[model samples]
Target: MTAKLWIDSDVCMSSGRCVADLPRVFRFDDEEIAELVPDADIDAEFDAHRDLLVAAVRNCPAGAIHLQEDGVEVEA
Candidate 1:
């Protein structure tokens, strides 16, 4: 399943886990908040790295990472 992913910067704590762990899918903005990488093919990433993506979400200290499939929030 193709899932949509996003980071809630307001809730992000600059933990850097996602950015460090999944550079292709996430990066830190100028303000150091995590954000999705520009032009990232989230679907393909999800397809190829489902386990890693889920782990990232589960490991995010601020719970700022989010994934949704079919309009429902994924539970990591």
Candidate 2:
């Protein structure tokens, strides 16, 4: 019912776009891939900043960002 953010670490190129756009919601792990903030729920945050998240995803060079709801991918 709502778009939730996630990153495919395997596909991420460590470009830091997501972290640059939204450091509060994204981080770089030890492996240098983009990762979500620990213990955070994207579905909950999506309501307030859906547009921002979409923009971040769109800017990802590696196309590693994804949005899903109910296990189905959502079109940004």
lDDT of 1 by residue, 1-76 (tens): 7598988889999999998899999998899989999999999998899888989999998899999876888785
Best by lDDT: 1
Cα miss at 10, model 1 (Å)? 0.4
Q: What is the C-alpha RMSD of each candidate to the true structure, in Å?
A: 1.0, 1.9
lDDT of 2: 0.81
lDDT of 2 by residue, 1-76 (tens): 5666788888999988789888889999988888999976677678777777878877888888987766777553
Clashes of each: 0, 0
Which has the greatest TM-score?
A: 1
Lowest summed lDDT over 10 consecutive residues: which window, candidate 1? 67-76
Give the 10-residue window scoring lowest on summed lDDT in candidate 2: 67-76
